[model samples]
Target: MMLDKVVVSDILSRSCVVTDLVAGNKVEVIEYLSQLLFAENIISDKALFIRDVLAREELGPTGFDNQVAIPHGKSPAVRETRMAVAQLRHPVDWETEDEVAVRLVILFAVRNADSGIGHIKVLASVSVALGDDEIVEQLMQAESREALYRLIVNNTGL
Candidate 1:
């Protein structure tokens, strides 16, 4: 289950942006996804969804290092297994393994725990992508949303 399989262009288009994401932790990740779901007309109760996702985050932080974070949950509030990625213009403390501030956030919403494998595979793919310093540098240097998207799609085959 490559990320290209689960992360479609629409989800990528929705969340890819260069901005200062003021909320820097798990709470922020949940809120970001909730807002995305609402804005995309994918969910109605933003508060409930955000709360559930945040609660799941309490068990452990989702920060995967190399300036990336993948936060997800299996909750009824999730209408589908959707994914969205965002790049913050400024780094924010996310409490990852390397203790490096996170600049990119990937949010995933699934309706069942059985989807864990799919999510893990996607994360693995992303981790592989990030392992290439050139790829990560190119992604960070991307000037426009379209350029950033193309970089990801081309590199990840998404």
Candidate 2:
């Protein structure tokens, strides 16, 4: 998808937002998010998709200093481009530049045959919005899944 045409709604949905996710580690978090995508039919095979996500993780850290992690996977297992956002029930150590614990996780499921960096472009848009500390704080403080969904849509304008 074209960068200008991309919006947060393109990859995010009400069902994809989780406010009280409880993950003990990166693997648990990734698997949990993959399950969400699988249930939505966005990922055809959860096992393969999880492998792809882990492979991408090996390329480099997707974690940010602000208690956020954006882990993505582009694979044939992906039926659509979508994202899942979770505010963990508890924070966990992540491989971030500043070694900050991650409380928010953004998982991206991308189709392998995509024409361009559609997901990354969307991520750029999200990153820009997340740059505002106030927005990030509000997202972290969101009381429920529905509230977090609205907060992200309102702030990211996607």
Candidate 3:
């Protein structure tokens, strides 16, 4: 798929957003998100998907500075390429590159078959969108799921 084909709103759902996610740690956060996605039918298997994400986490840090995290897993369990947002009630300790607390979790559920090219492109789009400090600030401060959705729509372009 092309960059133009990657619509932020297409992957993101207002229904899947959680503004006040209360998780004590990263593992709980991962499990919570995995369950949420699976419940929404975005993923076929919650347990397997969680294992995939944890395995990916073992490879390297998905958490970045400024309390942001983009955790992902590519598995056959993924039924859809979807993005779920969770703004934590409080920042939690996460294994981050800059070693900062994580307050914003963006979970990416990806199909294993398309892991090579499509995965990279979609992820890069989000990365580039997040590169803007203003957008990041907006995402961090968004009060509602609608606000979060609109921020992504504007920043990620048409």
Per-residue lDDT tens digits for candidate 2, residues 1-158, read 35646678777888889988888998999998888889999999999999999999999999999888889898889998888988998997888999999999988888876546655677777888877888989999999988999888878764
Q: Write the per-residue lDDT of candidate 1 for residues 15-132, one digit (tens) a residue.
A: 5343345565556655775687767655556777777777777888678667777776667776656666666777778768878887777676665643666555555666678677
Better of 1 and 2 by TM-score: 2
Once superposed on the true structure, which residue ranges of model 1 sit more than 4 Å away at CA? 1-7, 15-26, 113-120
Go through the candidates in order and give each one's C-alpha lDDT. 0.65, 0.86, 0.83
Ranking by lDDT: 2, 3, 1
Select the stronger candidate by TM-score from 2 and 3: 2
- What would the TM-score be for candidate 1 when compared with the true structure? 0.76
Q: Per-residue lDDT tens digits of candidate 3, residues 45-145?
A: 89999999999999999988878889999888999788888889899998887789988888899876655655566678888877677888888888887
For residue 115, give model 3's deviation from the true position in Å: 2.4
Task: Give the worst 10-residue stretch by lDDT in candidate 3.
Answer: 1-10
- Give the best candidate by TM-score: 2
RMSD from true fold, candidate 2 = 1.9
